[model samples]
Each structure stands twice: as C-alpha cells, then as structure tokens.
Target: MRHVKDVTFHLLTHEDAVELLQFERAERAWFEQHIEARPECFYTLQGVAKHIIDCLALNAQRKMHPLIIRQRGVIVGRANLRNIADDHAWVGYRIAQGAGGRGVAQSALKHLLTEARCVYGVTQLEAVVAVDNAASQRVLAKGGFTAQKRLPGYSRVSGAPRDCWIFEYSPALSHGLAANNTLY
Candidate 1:
C-alpha cells in the first residue's frame, strides 16, 4: 500500500474480498444515490470474490489497475484505471458515504492520477461522472480534469437515466502542448 496523507491505495487482491464486500454492502444504498446500483448478487461474499477474480483477470491482462482505498486501515473507497490501452484509461471510483466532504475522494483521485501517469505510463486519463455528482466533479477539476462533453443517456444513476459529462486528464494540459493527438 502507498500512502497519500492518511489514505492508502492497494492493488486489489483475493484477500480483500471479505472486507471489500462489507464496504460495498454497507454503502450500497448511499452509493446508488450518485451511481448505479450493483446487481443484488454482488452484495454477497462469494459474489464479491467472483467480482474480484474477474477484475484480477483484467488486471493480469494489463487492461486495468484495480485498487482499494483505505484510510487508517479501514476501507474508504475503491478506484481504478480501467479500459487501459497504450496511453489512456478510464478512471472511476466510489467513496463510502461516511467519508464524504473529508478530502478522501480528492486524495484518492490524486493517487490514481499519480498511478496512471507514473506507473502505467498513461498520459491520457478519462472519467465519466453523473452530471448531478458535484462532489466528484469538483474532485476531478481539482485533480486537473477538464470537461470534455456531455454524454446523453450515458448510463443510469440511482436507477434513472441520467446524462453524464466526460472529463479528461492529459499531461499535455500541464505541459502546455497538444502533443497527445489521441482522438477522444
């Protein structure tokens, strides 16, 4: 685990299944208010283990960076660099309801930015946020992501069709160059 302030990011592992399941179940309803709900099966231990296994498989294939976030050794969130390619990946995360407004998500996003940019050599990072999720929007902005566009009916949030904004992070923005030429 690597630490940023009091938060730590650990690569997802089989041993995390039980704890992660508990975190997910405990925050399921709260999370659904800002993101889509997971299928009922995902709330169980075995189901979580299976989900972890599947993510690990993607991880092994070099297509994802799946990590669990913690603060003082308690599960606070989960984040990832998924759909990874040569120099781009989609970033996503879920923070426990209790951790809201405590800088946890911002720290987690900062760590993910470091991981994606340094460890994975990913220069282009993308995040999709439900338009109504102002907390996450602020986190992304503070982390240097720029609004790209609105994706109409992108997905369901709280079981209702909601538009989303595609936010993007590119090192070029900091370097003041448009060299990243990768099409959005």
Candidate 2:
C-alpha cells in the first residue's frame, strides 16, 4: 500500500463550501460514471453552502454525519454516514478523480468505520454499490463489510436500471482481522 500522508477526514463546516465546490466540479464526471450525477445547481458555491448547512443541521440532530476528506489542506473527497438509526447507518463516499487509488478509499472507509463505531455509536453499517463498481466493492470488503445480497434493478445509473449489491459490516469480520486490523 502506498503511504498517503497528510490525509485527514473531519466533519464538514461552512468554511468548506468553496473547496468542496472545487472538488465536486473537478471530479463530477468521474463520479457520475459510477454514481448518479449531481444536479447543475450543486456545482455552485451557494448550492454547496446550502448543502453544507443542511448536512450540518442533520449532523447536529445525530441523523447523519458528513465528513470532508482532505489531503494537505485541499479537499480530496467526501464521505457520509447517513440515515443513522437503531445503531446503523448507510455509508457513502466519493474521492476526487485525481485522488483515485493510492489507498484513499480504503483509508476513508477505515476512518468512517472508526467514527461510526466510536463517535456515533453505530454498531452496524450498510452500503449499496452498483454491481459493476468493483473498486468500491473491494474497498468495502477491505473494510470488513460483507455482501449480504443483490438487489435487482436497485438503482439507476446514467438513467438505466442497474443492479446493486447490499453490503453490511459485520462485527465478526473484526474478530477475523489480523493484528494490523485487516482481513488480508
């Protein structure tokens, strides 16, 4: 694994709107290829501000946790644990196109898992990934999430029905982890 230095994942703040906008705009195309595209309004500063504000409000309510992934002070990605309830939440993450590989997704998943268990007291987490998105699938597996089942035509990617896999993190995965805390 490549050592990624100066990488940090922290709760989002109003001050992050500008950098977040830049990150989103820069990686929009890459992200859209795998996930649904964001609306045009989402590329604007005001839109980004509103997004941050909205997420912050939800965070305050403990309904969700939004985090900004940064590397050396620049926004590189975004991750969120949403729909938090009953000690469970949905995990979602996106890394900038330029920041792909170099273990960013794996690192971010680890950080989010840590926060889910530590800060949010969420014992279980789930993620839905497009069946063909192998990169994300590998990342989730590396983080101890096991595929539970496939949801046929569960999502629309690029306006077409797409199959998806439902993955849930298992505490047992932790027991099987090596001393370094990884399944491998």
Candidate 3:
C-alpha cells in the first residue's frame, strides 16, 4: 500500500472500480438506515457510485492523475486532479459514507494539493462543491482555499439544479501546505 504518512492513496484499477461500486452500495444502505431525515444531497447513491467508476475508467484510459484513499488497506475515499489547463486544474473528492469524520480526507487532499504545486507546477487549484456540503467546505478552508463565489444551479443533482460554492487556492501563497507526498 502506498502512503502519505499513515494514509494511503491507491491508483484506481478495474478491481478498484468494482470495489467502489460495492462501497456505493454500502453508502446507499446507509442512507436508508436513518429514517428520521435524509441529507439534502441525497440524490443518487448508485449514480454517484457509477460516476466514480466512470471517472476512474477515463482517468486510467487517459493516464490522468487520480487517487483512491485507503486506511489500513481498506477503501475509504477518492480525489482527482482533473480539467487541466495551463498551470491550473480542478479538484474533486468523495469520502465513503462510513469514512466521514476522519482525517483521511484532509490528509489525501493535502497530498494532492502539495503535489499539484511542487511537481506539476500548478499555480491555481479550484474546486466547486454543493453549497450544503459543509463538511467539504470546511475541508477546503482548512486546506487554505478561499471562496470565490457561489454559482447558481451549478450542478444538477437528482434532477434538480443546485447552487455550488466555488473555492480557489494558490500554491504560491500556501507553499507550506504539501510536502513529501508520492503519486499513486
């Protein structure tokens, strides 16, 4: 298992795709476990699971950089550096339902952000998250990203348009954020 300190980020493969889909199934089962209420972003457990598979398939085929997080060699989450453009790129992530609240997300993110800056010479890194996903918002904040704006109807989740928060960070400004991380 490859690692960044204690957290490991695996390169997604065909086997990884199957594992992610199962993880999605587990995540979906979680949504039903609580009958009191559901999260606002409760759109698609399966679709989102499929979405990750699609992303990994394309990433593998094109050799685009992507990483899947594992703790003690168990799948926990994923993050990708996509949409590359002239020293800038967009980033996105998903933490398995059962894996929330741990520092795994932040650790993987720090590794990615640091790698983008030092190895890829990325000057700007941006991310757009559903406005209601406060957990993600906090992650971006702790990683030194600042909100740029909110885009109305930026994402269509579960057939309804939803607003999203746009956040950006500059490696030139936060040079100390990432260090000694390996690419999966």
Candidate 4:
C-alpha cells in the first residue's frame, strides 16, 4: 500500500472483488461515457474475482500494477500502471462520481508516481484521455504530464471509435533535461 496522507492506494487483491464490483456498478453510466465499453460481466462479482486474479498474475510477472484508491477507508477509484516495458508504463485512472473535484485522483497519482519509480523501476509514464474529458486532461497536466499528440480513433467508446489525447510524464524531463542530454 502507498498513500498521500489519508488517501491510500492498495494493490488489487481477491478480497477487493466485492467492493470493486459495487464501485463499478455504481459508476457504470458515468464511466462508460469516457472509456471503452466493458463486457456485460464486468459489473459482477465473478468478473471482479477474475480481474483480481489476472491483476495479481500480472503483478507477479512485473507487467502491471493494478490498484484501488481509498479515502477515509472507503474505496473511491481504481488506477493502473500497465504494459510496463523499457522502464516505462502506461497509466490509467478513474474516480467515482462523488469523488471527483476533490483532488483525489491527483493525490493518488502522486503516490502512484513514487511507487512507479521506486517499486516498479519505471522512469516514464503515459496516459490516454478521451478528447472530451477536459477535467481529466487538467488532472494529468497538474500531475506534470505533457500532451504528446492527438491520436485519431485511438479507442472505442460505446462501440464507436473515439479520438484521444496522449500525455506523457517523464521524470528526466521534469528535471529539465532535454532529449539530447542537454540541460534546459
């Protein structure tokens, strides 16, 4: 587990299946608008159990870090550092509807950054945001992620292709280093 004060990030476990199912069920409509469509079973306990198992396996393989966000002892969201390779990982996050606008995602992400560097040995992080999700874009920017490019048809949402904005957070770049080893 990792945390920033009261907000905690916990690695996914089988015990979290029930809570995760409830969270996903509650946030289904809200989440579907911004993310790819989930399978019908994703909102059920069986699905969550399978998901936890898969996450644990991925963690053992050092290819993913799947976590849940907790504030005041209540699970509020989920985040992942996946596709780890070459000292980099892809980032993804989702906060419950009632949990938005409270800086929860940002704080959780700050903790995740530390874990990514120290625990996962990842030096770079990347996220893809739906073009219409301005709030998420702001959160990423506030976390020191810079927009890299616009990807056309980057993903499918509700079965339709959607464009997305790619953002990247580089620890070296944050320290003022240029790509060619020059200091800014």
Model 1 pairs in collision: none
lDDT by residue (tens digit), candidate 2, 1-184: 4578899988999988888888888888788888888888989999999899999999999989999998998889999999998789999999887888888888888888888888888868899999999989988887778889999998777899889999988576555642355432
User: Total clashing residue pairs per candidate?
Assistant: 0, 0, 0, 0
Candidate 4 per-residue lDDT, tens place, 73-176, comes to 88899989999887899988999998888888877677677778888888788999989999899877767788889999998988899999999888754664
Error of 1 at 129 (Å): 0.2
Alpha-carbon runs more than 4 Å astray in model 2: 178-184
Q: What are the TM-scores, per candidate, against the unseen true structure?
A: 0.90, 0.92, 0.72, 0.89
RMSD of each: 4.7, 2.0, 6.2, 4.6
Give residue 179's lDDT in candidate 1 (0 to 100). 31
Q: Which RMSD does model 3 reach against the true structure?
A: 6.2
Q: Where's the lowest-lDDT run of ten residues in candidate 4?
A: 175-184
* Residue pairs in candidate 4 whose N, alpha carbon or C atoms collide under 3 angstroms: none
Candidate 3: worst-modelled 10 consecutive residues by lDDT: 31-40
- Alpha-carbon local distance difference test for all models: 0.84, 0.85, 0.67, 0.83
Clashing pairs in 2: none
Model 2 C-alpha RMSD to native: 2.0
| Between candidates 2 and 4, the TM-score winner | 2
- Per-residue lDDT for 23-60 in model 3, tens only? 65566554333211234333354554565576677665
lDDT of 3: 0.67
Segments of candidate 4 deviating more than 4 angstroms? 1-5, 176-184
Tell me, by lDDT, which candidate is best.
Answer: 2
